[model samples]
Target chain A: MAGKPGRKFQLNEKQLGYAMVAPALVLILLVVIWPIMLSGWNSLFDYRLNDPTKSERIMTESLNLEEYADNRYLVEQGVNELSEAYPEGEETFNETWTVVQNHHEELVAEDAMASSYQEVNSMLNDYEPITDDNLRIQSIDGSWGSDFEAAMDEQIEAVTAVQQQADGDTAVEIGYLAAQLENLQGSVLSSNFVGLQNYADYLLDGRTWTALTNTTFFTIVSVGAELIIGLGVALLINRTFKGRGIVRASVLVPWAIPTAVAAMMWSYLFDGQSGVVAHYMAAVGLISDPGALLTTASGSMFSIIFADVWKTTPYMALLLLAGLQTIPNTQYEAAEVDGAGRVQKFFFVTLPLLKSAILVALLFRTLDAFRVFDLIYVLTGGGPANATESISVFAYKALFEQQNFGAGSALSVIVFVCVAIISFIFVKLLGSDLFPERAKK
Target chain B: MLKNQAGIRFYIFLAIFVFLVMFPFIWIFLTSLKPQNELTSFAWFTSNATLESYASAITTRPLFRYMLNSFVVSGLTTVLSLLIASFTAYAVTRLPIRGKTLILGLVLASSMFPPIAILSPIFNFVTDTGLRNSYIGLVIPYITISLPLAIWILATFFQKIPWELEESAKLDGATPFQTYRQIILPLATPGIFTTAILVFVAAWNEYLFALAINTADAWRTIPVGISFYQSEYTVPWGDISAATVIVTIPIVILVLIFQRRIVSGLTSGSVKE
Candidate 1:
């Protein structure tokens, strides 16, 4: 009986515990999971921002001579009727028939021009294809027989039916995509989804690859440099010194400055006439011109990476410093007693202890660098020919500037995959117990 | 003689390190004091200096507005986060919750979730709720951003507190809340201060959410202000340097005052986690 009470009590307790986690779980779903899910679904449709309802139509309006030629055939029949009306004026009738034929052809040419004008008008509606309404494809005029007209009628109806069907299908596909896309990058960007088409177009968009290339390059170089410099700084500051605390504070100042501010600060410094660095480099003849870096592609990338390295190096250093302190000075003392070199002590003890911290620092920084937009946006706006745009920037463009959220969402999905992969790798490399419990058993 | 050689090497190393480290600050300070006209003047060391830029940056904008937004956001975020995290951590560590370790690991893993990925949906949520460009929108995310660290810090600190105190307090018929308030909190002051300072700085320096959520001028922070001020091709460098100095000086002083607590916080923050 006593044990039976315990089971019931445990069930009630488990429910209450779940209630405690409910709020956080709800938040994570609302914020993180929802957007990720939405982006994935949006990738399946053609949602363009420029034309919410239709595609761009380029109609080639060459003149249609078939109608004019058909008028000639009708005139020949009419001429015979005229000749039959007056046999004495038959000679005059023949001369008049030739004139009549010429006049009919000219009139047919004008009507054909008017029809071309109508089709061009339809194409201009952002390629909203006109298939089922007042404009039936008129007959091929000069066909000279009922059989030819019937055949022409059949071809026209068939094309109209197919085009109308395609339009309805495309509209429906865009609609489905638009709904999914609206959730992710926001409907402010796009509201239509033409299936399979956006995917083809995305494959064609070079800006996606441009931003991808630049960002990937920036991430590697910046993270690589920061880790190296940060490790060096951590090692340098590891020893006993008089003013070490003050020095540590100074190192942290850059990290403490908000990244946006730090990014802008460097942007200002790289400007041609106004930047102090530009002026110095110009005076020393290191750079052939002043302020060229801010305006050039290589320079823009350099400025961003430099700013990122400056802002984040201290954070990296702090992580490595913590790792260094964990090495236990006794290892160094033991090495000294063993007549081992400094290099020997560093390799044997320091590197191994710092492995986890170094990885943690890299993981944090790399994820941050991949999602880098603010620094690039405020600094260069991906100017001077798409030099500084990252995956995040491309998404921003799709969502805000151009307003094509389907494509934006597809790019965001790519970013989400990258971050997930990196996080997975981090956990795999560091082992699941990276953040070990501090609870002393 | 060997000691002398080592001492000289140390001094030389210290000299070079000190110079490299101090160069940026010295550059900032010197540039901060320079006249606007000489900002582009090609001289490393300028004889003339003034407090004009700092004075102007303060006078040019509603400096107090930015400071107020930062303080309100940071202060409120710290308080709310600390209360939630402390309670949550305390319950996880002390209570007989089923699978507390699993729950704690889940919280730690939440930090790896990227903020930008969640930006749009949160923005939509806020805009829908009529909280966009408002102080609350900024504060809400700031708390979430700071939550994982807060829970981690408090959990680590709670682990260090002896369980005997709680047991005795319980034997004396003291309620859990009373025990926590009377015994645990007083001893946990160091941890509380460390967590507070860390959260405070983190919230204060947060840029993306603050910029994205608060588009209006009335509710902007220092980072947003600096970004706007950088809109020109030839930016106002002297004023920016002056602004940098203005923004950094307070946090620097805070770090200096709480030097001991900051060290312990750092030591614990990076403790194999």
Candidate 2:
């Protein structure tokens, strides 16, 4: 399939190498690196999806033209009716109407978007939804927007005072007008930008601290257990035996299962009422009762760690088995010649030689355990008072359930920082173990 | 005599380990096969086991559809990431590429980034681009996420290939691309195949992106679909277990068949040859 390349037209090897590698690097930058940077930037603001005022990443005071136009129309109609119905408060109605009309003109002039106002108003009249964000929202001067709000509040207060002096339908009409005036004031949208405030708030938040603690505890305990058990299993599987292939394949079964499915499987086994594992645990007196396994906080933490260990120890064993196989038999023979006991041989020969593999495996497992979401999510759902909530789950709830993007982004950055720190420590500990030639230089 | 005793102890220990590892699946299989009325009882075996749960699981939700979606997403991710990673692995291993160490380190570092950290921005971007429930949306991130490991495994495999063959090909007036396409690719097929299975398993099991990006019921992958099996009141353990068994059987079979290749691929970079 290769066409003949002209000698003068061909790219050099170095350029070709870069050309081949560029697509992957670009994809990583686009999908991974760029998104992380975007999350970091988003963490600086007070953004939310549920709150209309704080929804957009606004830097300046603005006016929501849709709300403004809708409320302005109601106020105009109510004020017209109020003046006609309440002859005694005609002067007050005219004064309030003038103040409202003047403020609307000032807001339009200050924002320099009279066209947007006209468009939104006509759309409202035609009963068409204002879907275009730019046409429905516009920036205005900060101080002027606040002053207009205060003026509207004062007018509403004056109208309320006059309405109190009237009776029956006349007072009812003025009250409705005053309420519309209040809504009109709410259309002045202020900026939601709060630099580092979300991070600051999370730093002070108890739930955030709890989430961090749960994540760290989960990572440490689970990875530690996996290391010990996985090493043992690795040594067992590494030995020469019949059907070793079958054993190795069976070991991968727990790992090969999708994590979400594993969580579901474990949840059934740990089910409070009907779970066999729970029933057996209670029978053996490892837990107080069969139902307590998932219902209690400590039990949940224990259950999750247990399931994680089960699911991932196989992976850890596989990695360590690879490392164990790398050790030549001569080293053990040398140990034997030195009259070393079994324990001494393991501590001296095996553990020493398997350090790199252990580090690599630990690095993968610890990072994985730290970022755990699906297992905890499907099994416990960070439930029973949110005691089992990992930072990832907490972040998921904030981003998706609460629709608080800014707070969620902050939590995401925290997770990134923790992962970075963990990786840095592991790499430092692994120093040159991973790349010996580069380290030698 | 002492050696024989130690061997006996090792076998016993191995048996226990295998039992502990496989018990969860066995228990789930039993649960799936039990009739719905017997699900609440903690029986090791049922008197009347049936395929009722499997029937219910299939009817209650589009389990086959979810499987198909997972296959499409994971399959595309595997093929695309393998193609991209092989080129990268080839470049870093065979060519006189500058910054090879830095490139390898970057690849390793990319894998270390927490997937949650990038979730929000990617979700927003996907939603903004109107690709929230599309295959390409999920496949793109899956490829990016799987690339690092695929590259690492493929690089290790590429390094093990003899350099003399490439030199000989160069002497025979074959261009580098031609040699890579005609010779290197054919030889690296086993490594590529192993990486494909690993990446496919990973993509199939991935939950977060699938949960976030493909919330549409028609586009749900197996993991997300299984997670949504719960109704408003009752938790249907029977149906869930049945679905779990159906989805997990193929993966277990693949892992069993390719045990040696998968192990070698996993351990390749962890140790020096």
Best by TM-score: 2
Name the regions of candidate 1 deviating beyond 4 angstroms: A1-26, A38-204, A281-286, A333-339, A438-441, B1-6, B44-48, B170-181, B232-234
Model 1, position A254, has a per-residue lDDT of 71
Candidate number with greatest DockQ: 2
lDDT of 1 at B243: 83
Question: What DockQ does each listed candidate score?
Answer: 0.22, 0.57
Q: Candidate 1 chain A: worst 10 consecutive residues by lDDT?
A: A54-63
Give lDDT tens digits, candidate 2, residues A65-182: 8888888889888878877888888888889889988877776674458878877888898999776777777888648788888899889999999989999988888899889988
- How would you encode candidate 1's per-residue C-alpha lDDT over A325-363 as one tens digit per residue? 777667777778898777887787788778877777787
Stretches off by above 4 angstroms in model 2 are: A1-8, A64-138, A151-187, A436-441, B1-6
Query: Counting only residues 3 or more apart in sequence or on different chains, how many pairs clash (N, Cα, C under 3 Å) in candidate 1?
Result: 7
Instruction: Report the C-alpha displacement of residue A317, candidate 2, in angstroms.
Output: 1.0
The deviation in Å at residue A410 for candidate 2 is 1.4
